[model samples]
Target: MALTPLSWCVGAALALVCGSSWPKMHSALAPENEVPLRPTTWLPEGKITSVTLPKGKTRRLYFTLKKASAMSVTISPCDLPIEWSLAARTLKDKPLKSLHWTTKKSMPEVWWRGPGTEEKIHSFTGDAVNTFSGPSHPRTSIYILRLRSKQQSTRATVYLHEGPGPSGTFPLLPADSNVHTLGVGMTSVTLSWAPSPSTTSLHNAENSYNYCVLVNSLQNYPSLCAAKVSMRKEKDQKQDKKERRVTVWPILKEWWWQQWDTYPEDQSPSASLEDEYDDLQCVCDGTDSVCTVSELLPDTQYYFDVFVIDRLNGTNAAYKGTFARTHEEARPAITSLREGELRWVTFGDLRSNSEQFFSFRPRGWQQSGLLTLQSCGGGDKVKVTVSSKGQVLTSQGVGGDLVHIWLQGSPSYLIHLEREGSTTGQISSVKDQALPGALMASVKMQISSAYHRRGVPSLPSTLQIKSFNRLRGCSSVTLAWMGTEERSLYCVYRRKLEKLEAEGVSTLTAPCLGPESRSDTERVLCKYFQELNPRRAVTTAVIGGLEPGRAYVFDVYLMRRWGIPIKYASKMVKTRKEC
Candidate 1:
């Protein structure tokens, strides 16, 4: 049974009062108790150590205090989201109750359960969560730290210092007041606030408080602001201010795998915000009362929280917050790129309908080129689609602000760049697609014919569309294709003939197919087929939920396991009229 907060506190207090020696415990419950132990290591004092936590596995770390002193344990900054607990065992304390004592080389280790003798100091779980203060014993004892990764394998850094940390109460003062913006720009916001009077005494540079500026695009500011800030006071050293770059291939592979079928509507607004903004929360230090928050989205409101933190303990002394919308951005003129030339393109000003299109022609027959798109960081907001002759070669969202696409000889390839819009409930005053937030990035788009020398990857020879049902139901159609390759990936795209004509989209130039469009006539159905049976030479698929009495064009693209769509076949079909 899990203990309530009150019960847990009461149990811990009783454990401290009835401190019993481990050796005095029942023989069966002694240190030489159970079988095999999990991975264990000793945590060194006064140095930083990096450790890896296997997925869903628990690792033990032991640290011995030489004397009775206050020890400070700091879990350094990391991206892995994990759960960790700190416990201390003294010579006079008995083995924690209900905890399995597994021995390794005759030494006992605790596993999970504990409602008795062991004093549990603290526990934390979440992404980028760090600890700065540890349990303190009046006398020397062994501190055992256990780390468990939630679902994925990740690395963690730990700093163990044997001494007293900074002296002060957590959140030393009340919440800050008069938190307001000083100025707002298309991509930045300047904020100013009054410092708590209690913090004025520590104005000296040596003992100054560091203000942690927490910014996020979501409205869940309270919990975000309440998160611990890990700031270590390290000696001055050269800092690498370079931003991290995201590669495009992994994202492209993911897009190809998902087949670009679902849209933002398939997910809840809050859940969408959580996933997209997981890395969007940025923390910076404002040593003074004023700070400037940059790299914000144009015409979007962002929540800001400033916490007065002590440098020593990394504790939030006080906090203040406000929300402000960025200024409207002017649409930038598109500059055409010549072959082998790199050009910077600005994306994300919705007032001017910031979707920009560019076309590229391969230099040789069936030639190939490497198309690279790069951003400062958080490039997932910029969506890219490369198409030739109305068939989408590839479409995917860029992660880490970087992506690469290999273009095979399409006489000319059309590239579309646009800001992915905010979801419903993001901004109540604006429509769902009206406000595009936080994607104001000057992404670099470049196309080079270097792949021509590398040789274009060959298309599958046996893949071809065999036939389709001429008579179709009001909402469905059947298509059959022949391919000997059992491991290839396939996607079926459907576009309305009437809408294609109205938009002036010819059978030869339609790349705009995907769920991104608002109208069914313009939307591309992202139907996927994978893991074809090797025994069967023919594969069949039924396209459903289509409009009746509508003439539609369907395209089948054959892709390799590596996510490159090499061979494709297109056909036009008309759905039967509604009865």
Candidate 2:
């Protein structure tokens, strides 16, 4: 016969056991003797079935346990006394624990004794219960379900269910090794490491993983910490807080600003997201084992570390940290020259349309100054414009060399040169003729002002402080100056702006009183001084070890041969806060 409907068998069994007339068998029924049973045949969880039972016959079914720790089976509405048993065996056919049950007053419920406490089994008339509980054992195991009846022909339905498997935790993987710096530069470093041993295993167990390279400052700069600021994504917020902790310093703002100095293109009002992303320091692929970190400060020491993060498990492991230092900045070359008694200052391969600025203070009875430009090569013609304090001087369509003389007026001037096409060349002062090789394009100037007689004492031209650049988060400042005189000594002095102001002294006038003639306040605060070489027409000084977040006044003095002060210049600047 074909298999019977389990619902029909259950209903019929209930009526027969209750003393009512036997119900008709389901149209589709299969004899117990004919039902297929095998040692490897396993029913899916929550499966139910019904079959006709021949007198004194038995049938068995099999299932494999994986991750699951226990198994349960139930039989209900049986017309005859039927017995059911469940047994477990290892993959090698070794027998484990076994259980048996028979029909009772109510439906029977049975479960394995594993992971959880034993549950009370409830039974009713015309029902059978069978359950097997035990350790799932190592690896995999097979389970067998056996059913039999001793009385006359009857049918019963069997229902099977399995408990969930145990939950697993992330495994501890080996950390990365052989971490080293591949390359270093003034503002960037490349790093590499051996593939993490646990990488492959993690990939097999999880969907994905990523490598995170961290850099910290080894020096006094607090902003250089390894766990400091970095490019982050919104999705990272979901990660555990411990995995996201990073050390940061307020001065980092200046460091980052210096790293990515504003470019002309970026400064435009119409910038886009794509542009911003492209301008980011460095973007390494998540899957890459090596990465480059950029936007770093020059001449700085930093500690680097590499770590792996399991995306699926949200855990991180770090490699050993390494140290690296960036190279120092290169200085520009300078050539000195003289025209009669006046010294001419010059330098550069000034590009077309690019402007150069210089500050100068003429003597008390100064008259005029001469500006000269000579093309080294490239373009055929050039246009040079010199402007100062509302006064303008333009020389256009000139080839080879050009000269423009003007009466001294303002204390500063801006020079701009342009060419017709995309040609490159250099321009320098007429006095540079003494130099042999082709001169790099440059602009030179010599002021023809009134001067003191032979042995007479007189002050040098006023000192001119040109530019001041403060390094972010550090106690350092780079100062550039012009209007330096030959045969004269130059001294740079700096002091706290607050102290200078409190003493009712100004850097411009204080130095004129001679170093010893100053009051205790002026002498105490302005004690830091450095003598610059007189040969340098244009000079740049890097002053470090200043107090952060404080303002200071700087003075540059031009001293005569007799040790008498001539002229002095001053400027004020503030240093970045913490870094």
Candidate 3:
């Protein structure tokens, strides 16, 4: 949902910004056959909160509301010989009934769908097919599909847009777009805007940028994401008029992770951009899985964007960043694990190709089937596993943009994909390797990638649960463990084992450790993990006061599901007093 092609400014500089509350701004104003724009419901005056993706195709366009009423979106593609598709669903997973497409693209052939609504789409290029097949369309953009609560947690909606390749922060953007003052050191600011969940391959887009900010409270930031803007201009700040626009083509490194202590006499695109552009996408190239957050600076208000870099004609987006004096660290550091890593998600072999149907016949070859890694943020990457069962494809890591992952895929007989995400995570256009002609499948591929963390974190691993003991009257307990000793950060969890009643989940949200450790120095090391040896120094916990002879049980947990789940149920154990 990039800004609609509509230009609000009559004279560019005279643009009038318009956006407010949802029910009021995007409610339906246009009637069914209205050919012209309505004052209240036109796209320029409406709000689009979600986008959906059915299996087999990347998301290209989505529905928007002129005033909370359903409105059809029309795309022109603007001189580019690009092909696109559409996916839609209710935020609650309900299949949207009635709606169809017909095109006139002539050359590449056309395909379209819509079972309920038989409106014949007028097209000149390809054949049309019905897309709304059945129920359970693998929930691509789950956020916009689900009901959201302001306090519980933010949900996310995902989209896969067409791209020139890796286009992140917009090219030719005004230099001051990201300039901000905050005015006050530590005040909360609310940003309302929209982004295009384009399915275009990150490798094809030449310019792009997305806004990302760490939000506090599962309630305040309940949308799972805020906005994806190229520049980070603080509401309205004043600076020398000369600094308003700067040619950023030369200094692209500013988009990645780094310090901007030295303002370039002129901005030079960071070489790192070119070094990693070809290898970026929300997921590992040639695979359905996506790349997660790779690096993040602690305690910095990073004005961030995801951009695809462009070159002699390939796609690309540049990573962008900005620092603010006072804003809480909004997201789990690139080093910290959010919530899903320890959870479970699966990836299956791509089953649908664009060519099968007549409505939207996607080229099975040009658009290789994809396996998606659930997003960390609607369009952010997540931790994914892509092992060839018997083959060794090392983790290559994400390039400059936050979406891409570098890996090797070739030959035959050895291909798989898996991912984990929910409304709390992100997902976007994930790239899969082009299917190789059986002859060149495997050849000592150096591809390497695993769960992409936003910052430096101890890799997730399996753990062995040891014995547990009771200590004080305060729901006291002790446990032993050993794993991820080399991790730069870690978190611990404790829960009563009784809740594991067969096929069940636990209502747990308790911390076992303080904020992540900043350094692995000797003093910090000794304070965290000590060698108790045979004694098995128990990691103890004492919540409020408990009855002396009460029975209690505890289970030690980690943010990772690397090993068999460990538990110590209170109902299964007795609470000891001064034992």
Candidate 4:
């Protein structure tokens, strides 16, 4: 059970009224008759001591100092379950300051009683250190130290040390120094540190000191500590008109990281060296124990070090360095797509009535295609239509930003955009295409257009090839296209125009054949064939395994169920010399 705040206050008052020594009846219940003082050589004149308390009991100790000054005290538990309080007071019973702490187990009995019998238990076990300065006194002065517990019987130990006076020399090195990263991001990191011994153990004005922080990239740059700033001077003209003086300003510490441009020109280092020390070093207030460093690159590792500096003496003590890595940004799946290859065409922008076409040459065992419209901008009411072989497959108004259209097999397409009216103005479209079980093509485009007087087409228009890119160092190229119908058949043909002209091969026309028919002249022109079902508005294809450094012309023809004139789109590409 826990005591209420009012009840706890009452208990503390009663303990104080009981005096420094317990009565015989209460003493008899305690395991120890008196508190013990442990001898130690760590303190020059003070002593280490301890006291044991039983349930609901308290103990008090008195100290007489030879001189008046500030003193440091550390109180720690002896691995026993208990709650304790420490208080300071003058011999006349004038209260000074007090601190309360506990070592209670975190988990309750219910945590270990259930099915999780093997669960680990946790508890609070830590120590506290404090410093207090007393009023100056010529004669010996008396002080009081009190310890109390309300729960299980336990022992508490205390360590006392004389702190440095106002004029004492600073420590040669820092103690109890710690550094750690508080937070990390792609371009910035926050850091925190505990106050050094020299800062906490001595007495001085708050603005008398400053701290220096150094940051360096461990993976690349070597030294980031090159820039330096000169101190400014303050002078009293009335005292000495002929004399000159200078004084360095105390550095200011901020709660968050600051950029170099935010620093004052007079207080900052040389501007010529700004880039050299942009994120390398910073000077902060001595009282500030936390700061942030920014302007870091993503996916990079960096090291940081902190030093306690005494501005008056220009003396500094360095703490150990800490390291952290920034996170990397996500990347696309495929960076490049070769021409004459079957690939999903995804991610491009198109304008109203702007015809986009692509030629796809299917390889062995390749089938199926997908077209997706991810988003559109300009807030205009827009509709997109896809067609092939003069047949409209899909023509629907976009209700939201995202739209998906699937094609059963590889087929060339002609995609067109149509807005409600000319007032709809310029719009941007983002679309992508993909093949089943294959990599997607990178085809991002930004389309800007003014509505034209040409009315929206009532039927599917002819296929148009939008763009063609040859894969570097490979005998392949990628093609992007639009406008196709659902459940339509298409064929891809590639011919070396230069080679054919050089060999004097005449153009031959062959009659259309059935689905399973193969003619010698048809084989000469037809490189690949595919049938599209449940059609899409956009398509992209890759053609590979051709002779390197050779120029080839590609033609995509939409096939119909009955014999009809071939409606086709074509593009020419040159393969790279290297594989």
Candidate 5:
């Protein structure tokens, strides 16, 4: 039943006369609560509070419970249609972004549907009864009752009455503060925040503090508690069925493989779907305020919410805002070190605790090479890691006056140099490797390799045209090639020969045209197409829809891994007059 203003006053008088004492629910009413809920407007147990909700504004108020009970909120005799919801508040001032409510910056009092409550809207025109279970004792559980005015300002008397229910106690946790990004790398993000402030000391069962850092790729934040946010399993069966059908056609299958190979693995379709829900990787169980989330996609925005979780009681609270973006993958500077050639690379403007990449292609390495590092009076602040084909071969710190890493094999290698220490800020985590203090350092890198006089070839193996047949159609032909280089790509270029021209373009003398060639009778292959088949070292390509009876010059070039395409083989084939 709804309580009127006169009836609520009479009830307050009775409670005052009986000398009944209730815990003060409204302890702190700062910007966290958003609404102008003062300490005087607190709703005592079994009493009604009158509040005037202004036009186009939301009014929020919270009440406390001393024991486990069924609670309900009743709003009566209002002029305009008001939208209101009763949500169990956990982690005061922490806003849980929901699809149901409009989340404002100042209004940290967003609605979070607890497990015991069936999230519903109550208004004066419809059903006003709401019942939910909440635990009490050890500490009071605060529930936020928000009333939103739609049409105009209206005065309403809100009554919050609790009844008897099963007795229990809920864990009381405080919200974290200053949640922000400390630093970001290609695949990692470092976060720093302050611990929650609580007066009551936690017991043995509620002693463990597992600070869960929920990361979401979307703009919205995750839920405060793990129970509130339900993570769903990804459904990939339908996608697998579609991929099987696409593989039946050879052309489509080849195109799909080419696209997949070129696409970054971090930004794939499956990667986006997997990040829709929250994961448990970023949980900082200890009291450390710094956490580095690793294995994330580069050049992407990620939202973070810190939850103070009590493992025993399953209670949690969300921290404030945490939004940071990872940086894009930096392209390494390529440097070709010839035999007996000494190159001195210096890093003068490198930032603290930041990484820089350098690609070193050593030619004619008859034996292992030597990489020496020298610190420029800053006592070895740089660490060097040498890797080949995405595999780390060795990593060492150049803390001493001299450091050397013996490079083995003649394959192309990569050198990752990272500077340590922070010139500013409290502290930062690099892949969870913490470095303290505000220090700056520089190092000079020198690389030299021994080799034979003969130049070691870094080019792809031979590519020979096997056959070019025009029997398929007058405008189409099947071209096949053989190559020894595995995972080699090819770009096909075609040029039509003039009919009246007496000079026949041979495979040797014919000019290998790029996509930009143009003439009256001779036309270039307009489409910038490249074929890749990782399943085989050699393959066949079917070229169709061409001008019949005209001789065409075709050139095939093997594309290098990081360089321009080199001319491998060429063939001149005339299309048949008819099929």
Candidate 6:
């Protein structure tokens, strides 16, 4: 069922009049003179009491009813009742955006589904509106809204009727002088009248108020209007001053834009920017200050000067600056095989003369230096070295200080480098894929000694082990060997692999090397080993608890002797748990 828009059909059918006869449900709800409606309802089950519809920026309805909440009845397009349809035709007004009829039952999902959710037309079945529930209170509807001020007209009409509905028509608002303060405490004020005398968005109404105080005191007349307007004009003048003055950014030499700002007021203007930064770039874009140099490659150094003309001052202001070259010349980072196949890489090293520019030989210490890729991915083991080999193109001369990195043929690995480095320009990295060159992989004699000289002993000296078994496993049958682990305080650990589980070492003895002992020492060692095998290696040394009847796992190792490898027994065994 649909209700009609608020209005009466002049020459339409008699039954078409709002609240005319309850003979049948109306398709629409138009304004009714008076009609009987049911009482004791949250919505206007009966005719709604006359409501005053305010106008202007704010428009709303106010009905004097004994209900805690309200349901905004509406005349939807479809299913308009006979009377509703007639009233709708008679009334001409703004088109509707959305309208919904609701009942209390649908309150919970109201905020979610919104106003027009119900399907069946009108008759106020308490459809969706009944469902619209809020904090036991409904937000007052505000319409005729002004976006900027959010102001609405205060004039709208309301229909009053007897419930089970109303009997006759009546204006809800009584004539009263409504005075709202405008620009309180200010000399000048703006006032507006709501429910504009002329209705609609295009028609604006002028509602004026006379200030009693200003009228009584003629002395302050200038302060209230005309003079105040003059003051406002002056205020605007001050604001425009900012637009008149233009500040110039300092010029820098080098190609990149300098990463900096003008010096603080206290800092000397002529103070040295010598090493502050070398990053700056500028585009003169063909103006009077049009760049003397037009075309340039990316990340290149540049210095420029422009004679800025001051239209107001009629003078030339010189803007000069310098900046360094951007990173146009990039060498693949230093990352390569730590072992396996060798992939050669170079950074800041010797280059053939043809590819040289302001070349300077790298220092002696730099010969063995490693360059950080800043970010490297996969197994990209890299080494830095100078090659006098003939791999230079005649035109591209390499400089002594420049390290021209050539991906020697296609290697087996495709390395991806992540973004790496410090905020302050550190080093650069590259993503590369290449095949292995004739310079096959080999264990460098120098590197072997280098590792040893660094106090790193051979792997054969200590049998601490890469792992007892799989780095991630919990089976108890496993055994660990020890290399030179005689003095090593050995312990065993167990935990559910993959799943989070507690790991510890404990003690329980069964068989040694499979029911037989290699020596008296083996027996004692094995016995003690069982005693402390499952102790909480990190927290305690109870040489603690172990499942008495199950064979517990153990790992053997010597502490601080990591660089050395110690010999090991095949597999020290423990018997089933006795418990």
Specify the poorest-scoring 10-residue window by lDDT in model 4: 223-232
TM for every model, in the order presented, reads: 0.32, 0.29, 0.18, 0.28, 0.27, 0.17
Q: Give a tens-digit lDDT track for model 5, residues 1-579.
A: 999999999999997776545322322223242453332234545443456778888777766665644555555323345667665444433323432133332232222322123233333342122233443332223556677776767555565556654112222334535587888898888888776542135444324445656666644332331212112111133444422211110011122112212234355433332332244445454566678888777898877766554433232344665778889987655565454433334444444336667666665535455665644333336678888888999887764234656676757778887876434433222111111122334455556563422322233334556554534467877776654333445656666677654164233322222222324333322223233433354556767668878776666665433222345455677788866
Cα TM-score of candidate 4: 0.28
Candidate 1 vs. true structure, TM-score: 0.32
Best by lDDT: 1
Across 1-579, the per-residue lDDT of candidate 1 in tens digits comes to 887999999999888667654334443342443454444567867554667778898877887777735777655324457788888765554455454333332233442222234678888887543555644676434678888887777666666777676334333444545567888899988878776554665545334444556665543222221222111111122135332121110011222112112224455322322232234334333336777877666998777766554433323432445779898888554445568666555654557656788877767665777777754323226678888888999998753323768777667788888767543343222122222233444456667665324533333445445445564688988877765434555566666677656354444222211122235554344434433454454667788888887877676665433322333445677778864
* lDDT of candidate 2 over 429-479, digit per residue (tens): 233333323333332233333244322333223355655553434587777
Worst 10 residues of 1 by lDDT: 229-238
Q: Which structure is stronger by TM-score: 3 or 5?
A: 5
lDDT of each: 0.55, 0.46, 0.27, 0.43, 0.49, 0.24
Top-TM-score structure, candidate number: 1
Model 3 CA lDDT for position 106: 16
TM-score of 2: 0.29
User: Per-residue alpha-carbon lDDT of model 6 for 1-579, expressed as tens digits?
Assistant: 555654345435555665466422232432233232322122243232222222222222222223433333321111111111000011122213332234332222122122322121222221010111112122222111110111321111122232331121111111221222222111222221222111122211111100111111111111112222333444476776643111112222221111112234575322443332233233221121222232233454432222222111111112222232323535544333342122222222123111211111222332221111111222222333323233331222111111223222211222322211113442222112211122211111011002112222222232333323232222234343423212334433332122121132322221111121122332212322222332312221222333433333333323222211122322323333322
Ranking by lDDT: 1, 5, 2, 4, 3, 6
Can you tell me which runs of candidate 4 are displaced by over 4 Å?
A: 1-174, 201-205, 218-283, 335-424, 427-579
Which one wins by TM-score: 5 or 6?
A: 5
Q: Write the per-residue lDDT of candidate 4 for residues 185-226, one digit (tens) a residue.
A: 988888888777666655772344456666555221111111
Q: Whose TM-score is higher: candidate 4's or candidate 6's?
A: 4
